[model samples]
Target: MPHLVILYTANLNFPTEEGGDMSGLCRALADTMIAQRDETDKPVFPVGGVRVLAYPAAHFAVADGSGDFGFIYLQLRMGRGRSEWVQQRVGAALVASAKECLAVLLTRQAVGVTLQIDVGAEVFDGKLGNLHPLFK
Candidate 1:
């Protein structure tokens, strides 16, 4: 149940002509999530459980109240069970991928990218989907 939510400022240049679009970012991140493995060499995150969603914040303000600044915040929410080492590994991989995807914009503009992992302790988490079958 690793769901990645990407929130980026509208000022940033997304969907670049070279195919650095939102869908491309999602594919990169989902691939990163699926590539993670535990110490036992087993998959860290389920392939069918990986979900990546991106949204642009049209109304926002970056550091120093300068509209020229842009930012991207990535939050990965997953069910609580994995060890700290696994979490850290996954986070590092994801952050690297995100940065790589945004490298051009980062160098050209005032942009900040941050990623965090949030282990959920949900009281009642429900789900209904047929995606697992497709993965099989």
Candidate 2:
């Protein structure tokens, strides 16, 4: 099965244009998050191979507000075992990653982009796998 992760911090004042610039603070936060992932054992994936994004649409299904500028990271992963409850586990891990210090990266003014960044690491389960979409 395919797994997804959505890590986000809300109410950030990011720019609206495609060329919009993220505040220095948010940039720093992203850098730090990457570093943390590189050192962490949770996802058990390397930083370079991971996908990180902001202005989410896939995993961070926002119910309220518009143009929210929260940061998000999605990482599709594998367990090498059985796991039907992966959704809950992925959701929990994302929520845990989005809390506190990094949350400060967002501002109330940047409500143009969804306060959701998507990071992904599509995994395969004895199948063709999500990686094919990118490599093929």
**Compared with the true structure, what per-residue lDDT tens digits does model 1 show for residues 15-56?**
466657667888999999999999899998888999999999
Provide the lDDT at 46 for model 1: 84
> For candidate 1, what is the lDDT?
0.87
**TM per prediction:** 0.92, 0.30
- Candidates' C-alpha lDDT: 0.87, 0.40
Looking at model 2, report the run of 10 residues with the lowest lDDT sum. 110-119
Q: How far is 113's C-alpha from truth in model 2 (Å)?
A: 11
Candidate that scores best on lDDT: 1
- Candidate 2 lDDT by residue in tens digits, 20-86: 3434334433444444322234433333334443343444544464555444454544344324343
- TM-score, candidate number 2: 0.30
